[model samples]
Target: MQDIRCGSCSRKLGEGEFISLTIKCPRCKTMNTLRVTRSEPVCPSASPIGVSIEQTHHPVDRRQTSYG
Candidate 1:
């Protein structure tokens, strides 16, 4: 499973909630609207198969998120 964090507060996101959530940060109390995206890069090397996941958080309009 991938780990996601809050962009504003840097807190790890709750399990099973990756799309978007308008919630208050437990540590900082900052109201954050989070957008989570997961990306995997393609490596051309043929030695051994390796996997890497890139997660990015952006504060986007809530209406654009899947939650909306």
Candidate 2:
């Protein structure tokens, strides 16, 4: 992973691989535009990785009654 920094303040903005992006700095409020092209491929995997999401349960309030 590579770090993206603000050009004006040099503050760390984000980190990731990107083709083209425009970001606003939170501290300096500067607009940062980026465009990148990789000379060599980074990964040799044939298929993309899958992301897993876990669901969370919230406690219900028993004191309130539903009218409908």
Candidate 3:
């Protein structure tokens, strides 16, 4: 099963145990905001940054060439 951890105290919480947008860490008593994603779990205090990528492909000539 997947595990959810408290960001403030690193306490382990059961998956889907968090039912609201924010939760208090039972161990540390620190207020933490939850952010869940399909690819990865994100830190609440983190911000998103923009990214860009470019790709190119070149084809090789297969024809035989004559030499003098």
Per-model TM-score on C-alpha atoms? 0.36, 0.53, 0.39
Q: Which candidate is the best by lDDT?
A: 2
Give the TM-score (vs. native) of candidate 2.
0.53
Displacement of the residue 58 alpha carbon in candidate 1, Å: 12
lDDT per residue, candidate 1, 1-68, as tens digits?
A: 55555667688756554565566656655566655454444554444344343344444444544663
Model 2 C-alpha lDDT per residue in residues 1-68, reported as the tens digit of each score: 77888777788988996767778777766777777543443477544354222222222333766797
Candidate with the larger lDDT of 2 and 3: 2
Query: For all candidates, what are the clash counts?
Result: 0, 0, 0
Rank by lDDT, descending?
A: 2, 1, 3
**Residue by residue across 1-68, what tens digits does model 3's lDDT show?**
34666665577755653333455556666555654333332776666443222212222344789998
lDDT score of residue 55 within candidate 2: 20
Candidate with maximal TM-score: 2
In candidate 2, the residue pairs with backbone N, CA or C atoms under 3 Å apart (3 or more residues apart, or in different chains) clash, namely: none
Which candidate model has the greater TM-score, 1 or 2? 2
Would you give me the overall lDDT of model 3?
0.50
Candidate 2's displacement at residue 44, Å, is 19
Q: Which prediction has more favorable lDDT, 1 or 3? A: 1
How far does residue 8 in candidate 3 sit from its true spot (Å)?
1.9
Selected candidate, larger lDDT, 1 vs 2? 2
